[model samples]
Every structure is written in structure tokens, then in C-alpha cells.
Target: MPTPIPPGSANETALLDLLRRHPRVLLTGPPGSGKTTLVHRVATRLADQGQACHCLAADPGLPGFGPPGAICLGRWDPRLDEGGGWRLETIEALATLDSARFRLPLVEAVRRLAARTEAGPLLIDAPGVERGIGGAELLAALVNASHAGAVVRLAPENAPDPYAQERVALGLEVLKLPAAPEARHPGHQLRTQRRTEAWDTYLTEAVEQSLDLVDLAIVGTPPPHDVTAAWHRRQAGLLDATGRTLAMGEVLALEGGRLKLLAPPLGDTPRTLVIRDAMRHSEGHLGTARPYRAPYPATPDEPSLRLPLQEAVDGPRPTLRLDGVRATLVNGVFGDPLLHLRLRHRKRSLLFDLGDPGRLPARLAHQVSDVFISHAHFDHIGGFLWLLRSRIGDYTPCRVYGPPGLAGHLDGLMRGILWDRVEEKAPRFEVFELHDERLAHYRLVAGQPMKALSPREVDDGVLHVEPGFRVRAVTLDHGTPVLAFAFEPDVEVKVRKERLDAHGWAPGPWLGELKQHVHAGVDETVIELPDGSQRTVAELAQHLLLSQPGKRLVYATDFGDTPDNRERLLRLARGAEVLFCEASFREDQAEQARRTGHLTARGCGEIAAAAAVGQLVPFHFSRRHVDDVGELYEEIRRHFPRLAATPGSDPYSEVD
Candidate 1:
């Protein structure tokens, strides 16, 4: 079975064409070869066209091989069996078994699983293709028993392959699938850490399934622990009454008579539950386990590079102010960004995106009265703990406003901290969740626990309204929910310098009083001038005070340049005096930027142009382009010729 000259298209199209010809295809490749990925991709693509496909794991010798809903017939990694992965002694004991006994049951298990997968095409994900010594016989056994129509080996381009020729000699049509560059494995430790997160994410919503002890009469392990618990923990197979695999479940917690299982939706009550310690799943979860990473030159025994606090610091940025707002990047352009903003000669100060807050100048931290969060990405929001911890004794409320789910995320951030034992009061936090329709509010007292406050319905996008300014928020297309803010100052009023010079009063209290009266809009209010003379507020406004539309300083970053979000962002940043946006990538990687929910350099310009902003300040470049942010600015200048030709070279001045 071979795919015909394939129509040029996505990998999905190519895989589907091959699978259409070969009903039972064996995906045989080494560890981290992306064989499991191709199988699931084919199965999912066929499933969309009303063609059902069954994923049969040839064997599960590893803990994270089975994608959710995959049917693994043979025994899995011993670490996950009846004795939990935590019980290393039991797992070590099981790993010492003879190769024959381990290889024998797999044939029977594959035969039994084959009968149930007859309803649709079979996508076989074969495991253990020469990862260790004495692994060849097990691989041979699985290949011979599967009786697949075709075998596809995923490997490097032009790489020497032994299995391709061997499988072809066995009368199997062979295809060479090259590995993707991004698919290069990070390492074993990184993979385990990644799997731990996957497990945590899956088990977060898992419910308890009560297992009657009598159902395990067939396993015959011992009291206190079911032998099947081991296999189920590795990859639990949930089956229907007809013994069809419904989904794959991950055993998270196992107490007496109750099993905490996290599986994909099975729809109805699963009639047969199969766990793998010593048992085999006769039958199915949607996400396959994440693909394995390819090995690099770095030895596994080598000490891993760890990121320490000093490593994250990129030093301070040159002081810059846009429209009286003193803007200083707490972390340099390439570092974890913590933008510090304070109104010159005014009490109001704010921290935007709290990245490496520990490095933030102590002077600035004390003045930060508010924090505006963009999103919860580690690079964006990682230093919030330092911020919260720093402001522990500060009694004044430090309001934190961001998109929805911020309160819960904050709780998770604070979980490791001992709240009860703390003597000092944490900064009083008023957390606000910005939604399109309304703002969900919550409050955390200095020493007390975080609790929800009443919700406030806002007609427009206004999240916080203060005497001097009001903040309007719009949701951005970041991987997580992000809120872009516009700080719209109330009608700006300033004393006319020429008028004061004309009066020759040397700029005293009269100037301040005139501006105050003008701001109040009190026409009849009389302000006593120098030399015992008085002027009406209306007259003072005409001669001395200058009033104009308030400065709208907008903050938007770490978001994708998508159509929907662009429209919302344009509205939020309409006519902004200064617009700070992210240029995480260059236009050349625009597709990748959009995929990652980040913006290209030109993306920032497009946003600035669309919003008709007075000044476009683009920062937050990806570290991959650290040596030359010139490329980012170059593409940005294409769309926004008005933008500075070079990075950090902005000529835009404060709008009067």
C-alpha cells in the first residue's frame, strides 16, 4: 500500500491519502520520532470526514506514549502500574523481568485489540524501536503480530534507516517521514517536567470513579493495592459495553474503592475499565501524549543549565517620559519587562506587566500605587510574587486590574506562601477582571484572605475611574486573556505661560487657583488676583488657563495582530497620545507570531496607524533577535514610515 503522487497540501492531507489506501498502517520510528503524532493526526483528520479511525498503541513501555483515547493492548511502563509511579522500588522490580515474558503477552493483547478496531481504519503507534539493548526482539514481535499494511518511519532527512528496509523486506510498504526542527526534544528532564504539567492540567478537572473491589478478582495482585492500578496510572483504557475503547484515562489519585481518573469525554458510563499494571486495555483520550524530543549533542549526564535571578536581569533602561508620564523600563528591552510609569509632579504612579519586580528600584516600587496586568505569561507576569511580597507592610491599597481569571491565578501564585503565619499585612489588593460587558471585582485585605467583591456592570469598557483619569480596557488575542488599557486623563488644563508673564506675578498661587477654577467649569467662580483685583473663572480661562482634550496614553502588548482584536484595540487606543505595543517578532515570522499569539514589528505599526496614535513606541522584542532589533524596526518602518527608522530612536514629543 503506497500513497499516490500526493496533492501538495498540509501534512494532514498527505497522511490521510496514505491512510485511505492502507487501512492498517504501522508508524514505526525511534523514540521522539513523531510517529505517535502522525498517527493521531491521521486519525483526527479521518474522524472529521465521518471516517472513524482507531489508534492502537503497539505497546506502551513508556509512561507518556498513549495519546488520550488511544488503545494500548500491551503492558505499559512499570513506573505507572498498580504501584504508582511514586513507588520506585516496585517499578524497579517489574523492570527486571525477562524479555520473553514481557514480549509474549503483547502478541495476544494485539490480537485481542485488533478484533475491536475492525469497524474503522487502524493507526498503529509502534513503540520501542531500538532505544535500548535487547529491545529488537520486542520490536520484531510487535511488528510481526500487528500485520500492518504499511510502515512509516519518521526520522531525519537522508538519515540511514534499518527498520525501513527490514519492514519493506517483510512485504510492508514503507514511507520515510522526516522530523520537524521544532520537534527536537528538549531533554528527558524537560520532558518529564512537561509531562508533569500535562498530568496536572488533566487531573485538575478529574472526577472520582468508584471501583468495586470485587471487579478486580481477576487481576490477583494483593490486598491494599490493585495490580491494575499500575497500568491504569500509566495509561487507563476506558471501554464501552461492546469493549470498544471510549477514551484513555490518566490515573491521578487512587484511594480505597475510588479511582480519580482524568480521561477525555466517554459520553456514557464506561462498561469496562482497563488499567495496565498487569492488565491490557481491550479498547480510548483526544490529546495524545506530547511527542518526545530528539536527542542533541549534550549528554544526559551533564548538569542542566538553570536560569537564576541574575541571569534574567538585563539592567536598566535610559529614562524617557511621554507626556509627563516618566517611563523607564525596569528591565531592559530584551529582558523580562517591568515597565515603571509615574506622572511627573503628580502622586499617581503605576507598574505595567510586573516582570522582574525584584530588580525594580526600591524608590519606584514604593511609588507604584497601581499595577496594570497584560496577561499571565511567565515572562509577562512572573515577578508579581516579588511585588506582592515587597508590598507586604504597605497599608495603602495597591490595586491590581487585569482580564478575567486573574483572581484565581493570583491565588495559585500565592499557594506556596504561608499566609497564616505571616505577621505583616500584604498589600491591600483590589483585583478587577475586565470583560466586554462588565468588570468582575474582588478584594484582598492587607492581612485577610482574598475574597470576591460585587460585580459592577459597565456600559463601556471603563474598568477603573479615578478623579484625575479613567482606564478603559479591551481584551487582546494573547494565548491567555490580556487586557489592553487606555488611561484617559480628564480634560487637561494648564496655566498660560505668556499670560502669567504678562501679569508679572512670578507664577504663584493665583495660577494654580485659576487652573482649578477652569477645570471645575465654574463660570461664576471668582479668583482674587494680585494687586487686590478679582477675575471671573470664565475670564481667567480665556486669559490665563489653556484647556484641551485630555491625553490618552494607551498600553497594549504581548498580543496577536488578528482582525477581531485589531478592531477592539483600535477602539481602545483611538487617538492615543502615546501607544506602547509589542513587537515580539519581525514580519518574516508573522505567521509564527500569529500562531504564538504574539505580534510582529509591522503588527505594532499597523495597530499604531489604525489607532491614529500620536506616538508609536514598540518594545518587547523576542530574545531570538537580540543582536539585531534593526530587522524589527525595519519592517515596522515599512508599514509605519512615520515610526523611528531605528530601535530606541523615537522623535515623537508630548502632544500639547
Candidate 2:
């Protein structure tokens, strides 16, 4: 189960041995989890071994993963057809998509593709998600219809899969998934630059190239749109006879079957064979449509912007846990505004924010018991649908606590996709909405049309009350209802071993009961010591128990620093051991911060100082400061100097 492919080696001897027996090997993982890369790598190794291998692109956004005639669905470009990429998307598959008979056409398409393939073992490349319900379902169907022999998932056990529980029932051998060591999220802007750089490199230099289209063929399943226009209108890559990308070219004229194109200079024509129509898109192309096959997908012309920030996608990281909790910036510190506070108290797990949690490790997503959303902004809650889909069909209920309209937001998200087939078993959603000094609660099970829930009036401000801790919430001025939460753990009772030994009573399980009774203030409660002697809980605890206040953590972000709001935060965050707050801008951009319902570093420091927090971890900086977030930190540090590490720190460092 260790990685079949070892580190520093692309050697496929082990992989080829497995491929002889397994016909269809499906690869899946989270975004940047390297599922596609693994498929490509494994296919290359198989080809080197003289085994005929074809990789099927189950995810449309990525295609041409194998040699020409490879099976690919979605994103059919007219120019790339000459590469021999087999279009797996059938007309019937597109027509009957999401219908009551959804699986039939897709299953037929898979079978048809398998029938035509004359080459080696097939590798199906599936779209990876930390939690992708639709993708998983689609993968399950493809694997079953294709008669896959094995699945090589590139993620942990909690990775998204529709048939995760039913795998054994389906006779599928689940290979041990391995994390790609080279995987790293380049971030939004950086990823965009990388794509642009590829385009820029392809477009460098200047020349007019003649492309003979008489023998050209397209690589994708032609869309319903006019095929000629689809070719003429798209950006293309000119390929050589050997199928190597020679240069990028913009189509000039396609008259009389002779294609005129402009591209970088080449010494000679080298007999251009095909023009690839598709251009790989980076995540930052805000309104661009990514038409991956789906029950929930924007149209080709529909501009739906989804901004996801990845943490582990970039590389392996040092532990971010602080005081028994993991505090991760959902977005980069200088990137989007998303913070994830993972509280691991005992076996219980709690989450803060629903930002771009697509980057969250699959292993962590499975442990989440509750999520607290600060606001409903796209940058704050963009990862909501992914998180929900990840937990789909989960028997465990995950509670969502948020400001007003939380339930409605979740309802709209669920209704966006076609769930006609899997409505009976969906994740149980328990949403709690915060009103001023009150809370309303609602529960929803997916697959049914959601209705507006009139939250029952709970006058108490407490959002959650656990056995050893309680959570309180308040709305802030964030142009919308933004809630800030505080977790207050109960005081701890330490049994005085010295006093117990002095009393000639040996410590035992009775001390635990005594401590519990002491915390409960049950004076009449009696307990037996090791010697079987009975004593009142109050008397036993009088000498043996010493109480200490438990810790508190406050998470605040995406809010304007109005005086009233500041005063409220000060009261709620008072005496917090840690305060994770947003410092979106610097003092120079104070006006901009206020206009955006955000806060400056100076403002965050002032609020933290007023709250008298032990530590202030500032984040959610503006993109303008992407050059360096250190300046904002320095500005905030001026107010709350680095006294925690300083020698002989002055008492003045302690805020009121």
C-alpha cells in the first residue's frame, strides 16, 4: 500500500504488473491532489513497457491526457481533433443529462468508448475533490459501466466518493491513495500568471503560418454549436506531425479549407497537422465558464465566478496547531479573506468559517462536527457547496451556525444542482441563524426543495452550550450580517494530591467523581474512597479541589470598525487567550477599509488591545499588500509590541 511509484522514480514495473490484471484504473483526488498527473505518469510508464495504454479524461476541463484517440469527455474543441483524442461525450449523454434516467446514457457512452478502444488498459481520470458528491457519483457510474478493475485514489480515506461505503458491494479493489509530494497550490494570481506565461510563451515572436485543414480532424465531441465557428473563434495550438505543440496561433482565415494563422516565428513550417482549440484556464479568470460534466454547471456563456484558495495544495506545511487547535488561513495570508479555526478539544472537532475549505485536507474534513460562518460573502463562504457535498450521505449530522439567512443560503446552494436521483439519502443539515440577542434553528435533509424556516425564538444569546464549554455570538457591521464567535471553556477543577495524601486517603476514580460533583456544586453528593469510606462531595472537595479559569478564543473578521461594534467586540472578546482578527488594510488605506466594511491593522490592534487578549494573530490582508503583509503586521505590532518574546517586558505592554 505504500506508493506503487516510489519517490524519485517514475519506474512503472510495479504499476505495469498491476495493470495487466486491472483493465480500468480510475484515479481521483482533491484539487491539485495530482490525480491527473498520476494518470499521465502511470500511462507513460505503461507505454514505455510496450503495453497499449489509453487514459480517459472523465473530467472535461482536462483532456488529451493520453496519446491521440484517448477517451475524453466535455470541452470538445474542433482544432484538437487531429490529435486523435476520442470524444467520450455523446449527444445522447448531453441531452439526457440529469434526467430521471441519468445513469443510462452515461453508461452507454462509457460502453461505446470501451468498445472502440483497440489499445491497452484504460485509466479513467476523475475530477478530485476533498468532498465532491456529484463528481463521486459520476465516477462511480463510469467505473461500473467501464468495468474498472481497480481505483487508485490520490487522497486519504475521507476524500470525496459517491460509492465510498458501497465499494465492497461493487467488487472494486480500492488501492491505497498517496499524496503527491510535488503538489502545491500556486495561488490565484500566481496560477493565473503561470497560465498567462504559457500563453505568452506560445504567442512570442511573429509569423504567418499556413495550416492545411483538408486532412484535419477534431479531438472532442462536437458541441451543439456550429463546428466551423467553434474552430474559427477559439485560441489554438499548432501541432507538428509528431503531435508536439509547435506554437500557439490565432485563426485568421479558414476559407477554402486553407487555414491562415499568426504565431511565433519558426524556421520552417514542418507540416502543421492540427490546431488544438482549448486553452487551459487559471482559477482567477473570474467569470469564465468551466464546463466540466455535472448536475451543477454554469453554461458555456454563463459567467459564474468561483474563487478557491488552497493551503496544502502549495506544499507540505509546518503544523499550524496552537493550544490544542489548528488555526489555518483558508486563503493565503495575503490572498483571499478566509480563516479556518479547527478546535480539537478531546475527540470533538469544531470549525470556524466556510471560506475556501476546498483546500482543507480530506482527513480533517471528516472530523468536523460543526462549522461557524462569519458572513455570507463569496470570499468567506465560497467553499460552502464543496463542504456540503463532501458530507453528502453522511449519517453524522453537522451543525452550521451563522448570521441571518444561513439556512436560506444553504437551501439555495443545494437547489442549484439536480438531485432528483439521490434525494432520499442526503446529509442532515442543522442550521442555526443568529438574530440580535436571539437564535433560530432549522434542520434540512438534501434532495427536497427547502422552505423558509421561521427560526424558533431562543432569547438567550448563546449559540452552543457543550458540557465543558459554551459559544456566544454577536453580529457586526460587515455591510451584511457578520457574526463573531467566542468559545468559553468551563473552569477546571484540579484535585490536590498533596492534600489527599495528607488526609491519608489514596487517590482513585472517586476523585474524578468528586471533581465532577464539585464543579456541579452538589453538596449532598457522596462518594467512596479507595478504603470504601464515604464522604460528602462538598467536604471531600473542600480540601482536594483547586479551580482555574479555562481558556477562551475569539475569531473576528470582515467587519467595519464602528465605535459601537468595537465596544461590543471588546466586551465579548474580553480576557481571550487568543484573538484571530482581520487586518485587511493598513493605516494608509483606512478609508478604503472602512468603505469595504473591513478593518486596518491599526484598528485590529486597537480592538485586540481593548479586548485585552493574550495574543493577536492578524490576517485577511488586502491583495494590494500582497507584496508584503509584514508591513501591516509591523503597524499592528507598534500598538501591541512584540512583548511576548521580549526580555523583561514592561507591564505597560499589558493592554487594559
Candidate 3:
């Protein structure tokens, strides 16, 4: 009589080889060794490899292991008894040493388990016996009678139970004494050995199942928090093939082998990175969050260490280079139809209302997004012909807003008699007429084409737009109905002193983001705090309401002797950093100025003083006293000393 061995053990493999047949396998192990799990793994591997195998778990709770007619039994819970058969138990179940009639259930359960198809090798997870139990003796009896050929033994992981060991020894002695029952079961055998190698197989499979790797490059992968850092590490070498790393979110200045990215650092890493040898351009980059594409090869033949030169500044965003933001005036006094305007942005330089009718300058040919008309008078829009003829490839469409009849006026201008001798295709013209009705604006493309827009007619209101600044329009009665525009940048500064103090913070790029958050509304703003927490824009605003201040600018022009109208203008212009007004006459001609509905030099100063503005600039003057402009200025200065001619002679001298 020997203890049955667990399958997958070295000793059992040798014993099975000696028996020349598959034996009824019983695997036993300590609590966490996964003996039951190992049985399923082996069965599944054999089935998947095309060897049909029947698996079963004889549980009292379940009639048998899961569904029928399958290569492997799915899953089973053994607690529910299906048959009214006698309960089966080994010596461990007989610790109370019940009457002989009670042993009927134990023998019945064992008989049923052994009766289950001896067609293939049976794998069983043996239960452990209680203290002082004779498990080996009972197993030996069942094996001798149940045709469990070539019995193999397994050892417990921990120290074996001394009581069970003694019972097994006693059983062996009783069976070897020749008084044993002549077991009718075929090929019956027994073995006992201290071999626990089967547990290793189960443990190995469990480890592999717990450790698995998966690819995360697919679409559903969650976005990483440190996107900036991730991009720099993963995309830097790939995108920056030129060996010249350019800051994607900032402008960089290159001078004398020094490189400087316009944006400052965030957290620890610089928000803008610069490569020393990067070949530079005047227009580095523009717009928000634009990806960078390297324009040079990594091994450019002549690699000079071209870098950005740095300049110390105090503002959040600084002007790194000058393009064409130049201003010139042709006539400041005397009603002359002459004017010039040049505005430059990061992308292009635009010149508007150029009075020169001959060959136009290259800057004047660039596309213009807007045209602010002083009036429909010939002098202000004299360059209309050159603008209509200078159209080139892919120019951003232009819109010119003017008084009521702007559409007809432009159509007539483009269809002027002088165009008969012209030899080139006419530039595309899109005119917008501003009427006094609710549907106040309408687009008139190339004269005949027309499209109506929502009625947004206001004598004085702000025109909101996306990327550009806001335009505040004021109607000035310059003979005819004239409108003047004031462009204000969208950036607004807001303070969060309490939050800053709480974190013991210093001023940096975080403040800029904070300001953006404030303007973008509560939902849009994300205020990252020093302690890794974030507060919305609304929260930040309410926290430090006193520290934040708002700024404004006002533009007023073409006022008659209407005191009420002038008063309103003065109020709007009050406390403004810059104020632009018209000085169309001298103080001596008050009656004439009153009749003409325009502001004289003295009148401009009066308004500036009354409004308490910081700076007063007078344009759109009458040519009646061009040479005596000094006299006009002297008259204005005599009353309001703060109103001065722009630095030198007059900045608006060309606005005649």
C-alpha cells in the first residue's frame, strides 16, 4: 500500500513509464499552490492541440463538472447535491468514528467517483485530511479495489501531518501482511514518496497569467498629462531633423550665434526651446499651437552656429522684431484728397488708401482684411483704383465698410472712365454697404453681386471678431456721415493675489494663462495652482476681485456745435490713454466750424481737456489754413496745454 502520486512529477513520470499506461492522477498541494487551476490548464492545452479530453470535477454541490458532450467540462460548483446517494468520505471524514452503517456514504461516493469513465486518465484535486486522520489507509483501500493502476505519491509543501503519516504507515503494513482483500480491480498499484514537484508546474502557469503586456499606440489610448514633455522626448529627433530645435509655441530671435525663444519657461523646462545652429528667419512662427516642420537638413553643408540673441524685458509678451508697422501722413490740414496707411502684422504688411494712382508699392498690393473709411469723399479713398488692380494669388479676401452708398460708390470707382486704357485684369473687390436699417450691412461683390447680413447697425458700438482686435466705431459728422474706428487688443490682465500668496508664488507665465482663463469665461479657464490643484476663472476672479483692473481706449471725430453730442464724446474719451479727434478748423472760424459740423484745432483741445485724456492726436483737418497749422496748434495749446503736436511737426499732416 502506497500513497497515490500527483501528476506532472518526475517520480510519477518514471512510474507511469514502468506501468506502460495512463494512471488515475490525483494532484494535491498546499492552499495557494493552485492544484485545481493546474488541472484545467493541462486539459485545455491538450484539447486545443486537437487531443479530445473529457474533464470533470465531482462536487457534491454539483452532480458532476458542467455541461455534457464537450471535450472539456466548463465549470462546476460542487455544493449542490444532485443524487440522493450516500455521502462519501475518507478516514478524515470519520474523525468522530461513527457506526459502520455511516461509512456506507463514504464508500458510495468513492464508488461513484471511481465509476466515472475510466476511458481516459482522471485528474483529481485531493482534499486534505483533518488532524490525526488516516487518509493514506482509506486511499490505499480505494486504489486497490478501484483499478487505479500505478499509484503515484505526492508530498505536502509544508511538514507532513504526523498523524496522517502514522496512519499511512499502518495501512502499508496491513496491506503487505498478505491478509489484504483480493482487489478485483484491474491493474491496481500503490506508491508513496516525498515528492512535491507538481506544485511548481501550477505556480509557473499562474505567474505567466498574472504578467501580460499590451500595446497602447492605438486610438483609444488615454492622453498623457505631460504632453509637452512627451512630444519633446518622442517627437524631437523625428521632427527636428535639421538638428535645430525651434520652439513650436513661441517666436525666436537669432543674432550673432545666440538663439532666443520668445516665450518664457513653464514649470521648470523652458516653454520655448532654441537650437544654437538653427538658421533663422524674420518671421519665425505665428498663431497658437502650430506644429513645427524642420526646413533644414541635419547635416547642412555649412553649419554656422547661428543662435538667438537675448534681450531683457519686463512684459509677458515682447516685440522681438519690427516689420512694417509704419505710419505716414500726406495732408493734416486743408481738404486734400490724399492719404496713406501702412499696418504690419506677423504675416504681412498692408498699405491702405494710398493716394498714389500710378504704379503701386509692393506693400500696398498685399491683401487687406479691413478698410476703415473716414468718409466717402474722394481724398480718403483715392487709392481705390490701385487697390482694385493689384490683386494677386491667394490673397485673403478684403472688406471695406463705409457710409450708406458704399456699394454704388465703389462700383462707380472701379468702373471709372480711366480704366479703359488699363491692360490687366481688375482686382476682385468686395464692398459692404452700411445702411441705417436693421439689416444694415450687405455685401456687394464686383458691383452687381449682393448678399445681405444680419442687421447690426449702431452709431457707437464694438465690432467683435476672433483672432484680431475689437473695433469701437464712433460716428463723426465730417460733412457727410463719417465713422472712425478704434482697435483694441483682446488681452486683459487679471490678478489672483490671494491664490498666489497662498502658494508663495512669483510672477511668471502662469499669470498669462490666468489672464487668458479670465477672459475665456469660467468654463474655458483652467487655473493651475502651485499645489498641483486648479481653480476655474470664476473662482480666481471672485477670490481677488480688488487686484484686477480693466483698461479702455476711445476714438472720437467729426463733431458739430451739438453740445450734447460733444459731451457724450468727452465722457467716452475720459481717462483713455490715447484719443484721436478731428481738427478741421481754427478757433476764429467757430461759426464756419459750427456750420460745417466738424471739430477745429481749438475744439479738439477743448474736448481733450474736458475728457481728461492722457494724449490727444488731431487728424482730418481742413486745408483752409494748411500753412497756418502752427497758428491752429497755438490756439489749441493756449487753452489745453496737454494737447501737443505729435513729437515733431504733425503725425496726421497727410490726412488732408
Q: Name the candidate that leads on lDDT.
A: 1
Worst lDDT 10-window in candidate 3: 185-194
State the lDDT at 566 in candidate 2: 95
| Candidate 3: tens digits of C-alpha lDDT, residues 307-408 | 112111100001111122333333322333233333332223323233443422433455355665646666667777666656533455566766667666
Ranking by lDDT: 1, 2, 3
Please report, as a residue range, the 10-residue window in candidate 2 with the lowest summed lDDT.
646-655
If ranked by TM-score, best first, what sequence of candidates would result?
Answer: 1, 2, 3
The digit string of per-residue lDDT tens for model 2 on 202-268 reads 3566577776665554333322222243334234544456543444455555666666666666544
Candidate 1 TM-score, C-alpha based: 0.46
The TM-score obtained by model 2 is 0.46
For each candidate in the order shown, give its overall lDDT on alpha carbons. 0.59, 0.57, 0.40
Per-residue accuracy of model 1 over 1-656 as CA lDDT, tens digit each: 76674322255565677777887777766656666556655554554576655666653334333332222532222235442221111011111012233455455456566655554576667653453333555555655666677767777667666544455556767766776533433333334344445444544655655545345331212213443333344345555565545555566556666666665555666666553232111212111221112211222332221111112223114245554356656555567766667664453477778787655544345567788888877887888777777666635777888888887777677765667745656566788888778888888754466788888897688877765568788887787788888888787877667777787644444555565555555679887665557888898788776667788878788777888889999988888877777788988898889799889887888888878887776777787875455566667766775542112211111100
Candidate 3 TM-score, true structure as reference: 0.38
Off by over 4 Å in 3: 1-345, 348-360, 365-367, 417-426, 436-439, 447-454, 457-460, 492-559, 647-656
